[model samples]
Target: MTIDAKTPEEYISKVPEDRKEAISKLRETIKTNLPYGFEECINYGMIGYVVPHSLYPDGYHCDPKQPLPFACIASQKNFVALYHSGVYADPKIHDWFVAEYPKYVKTKLDMGKSCIRFKNIQTIPYELIGELCRKMTAQEWINLYEQNIKKS
Candidate 1:
């Protein structure tokens, strides 16, 4: 589904009322942990925190102007998703998350290439989540994600 959100406020407005608080809280958490140079914006139907294409002029992930670095927080019909760049390349972190997350959440965590679909804010392991946020930079994440793409 294409979420036509022009601003973050608009994006939050689109989310169901029950999910808004959790989404907002997660948004705060992500914003607090992001490294320097990353910016939050609306992209591809979700709340995408990105490294603007303008900042990395040489190209994104080795291709000039090709891709941007992003961490997304998305609201779905049934749950919210936290899309972070760390998941694709860091086996240790991925393993930690997979193992520990279920303990905190009531519902299952759904995953995609780099997306973590979760039910609500209460399910998050704040410390580990914060660590994941602090560990990745736009360039580092872009490199890792690119490697995964190549491997796949």
Candidate 2:
């Protein structure tokens, strides 16, 4: 969780032993459902999927040297988190998730603008999560990100 990891394996390995299974399982789900053209790697100290520099030369708006981030999974001290940039950047996406979550999940949702926190792995809705991961292609995300940035 320290953002010191240089690789996905390293990032996962650094998670506390008790949280490893949940972390790995969630990671697997994300990887399996993630859209194409987005590359996986360690970014900002978490296991991140990014739009590679070759695809987006502008990089991250805040840090041009880095690839534009799409999503990330991390095990924090109190909870495991899934960060999807799309849900925050696009209102329609955010609304879709919010509206659809209750239909798929029985437990109360614990989420922020871009992160969904899970304290209990059993309560996590893997199917809905995967759908969110696959909702848009890499190019679609780029356009959405750019549109949001311009509006800002």
Candidate 3:
């Protein structure tokens, strides 16, 4: 889905009302632990947490004009997803999340490498999600990305 909203509030407002609370809670949890320098905006049709252009002048490696993506919350057709760049870039972080999740959430994790899909909003482990969101800063992400590129 193409995100037409220009601002985070506008994006949030456009979300299905049934999902507003869960998305809002997820947004808030992310914000609470998000390090300074990352900004929340509407990106790729979702509420995206990003490393603003001001901080990373080059922007995303794939698209220099666009800000680097860090994380995001999206209301998809079938589920709500929380996308975390940290987990995608760092295997240790992904492992930590996988090992820690079962302790906090009873439902099986519906996750890919980076996207955690919540088929049922009530199944989300809010605290664990917040901590995962808190795990990296913009600089840390940039460093990790650079390291990966170098290894490539």
Please report, as a residue range, the 10-residue window in candidate 2 with the lowest summed lDDT.
Answer: 143-152
Evaluate model 3: give its TM-score: 0.94
Weakest lDDT window of 10 consecutive positions for candidate 3:
143-152
- TM-scores, all candidates, are 0.78, 0.92, 0.94
Per-residue alpha-carbon lDDT of model 2 for 27-125, expressed as tens digits? 888889988889999888888999999999989988889999999999887888999998988888899999999997777888998998998877778
What tens-digit string does per-residue lDDT give for candidate 1 at 1-152?
45788988899888888788887878888889988878888866788887776665544444544437567888876667887767756887678778876776657777886788775556766666776788778777666656664333
Our tally of clashes for model 3 stands at 1
lDDT against the true structure, each candidate: 0.73, 0.87, 0.87
Question: Scored by Cα lDDT, where does model 3 land?
Answer: 0.87
Clash list (residue pairs), candidate 2: 3-45
Q: Report the error of model 2 at residue 88, Å.
A: 0.6
Over the stretch 40-143, how does candidate 3's per-residue lDDT look in tens digits? 98888889999988988878888878898889899898899999989998999999999999999888888998899998988778999888978888899989
Which residue pairs overlap in candidate 3's backbone?
A: 3-45
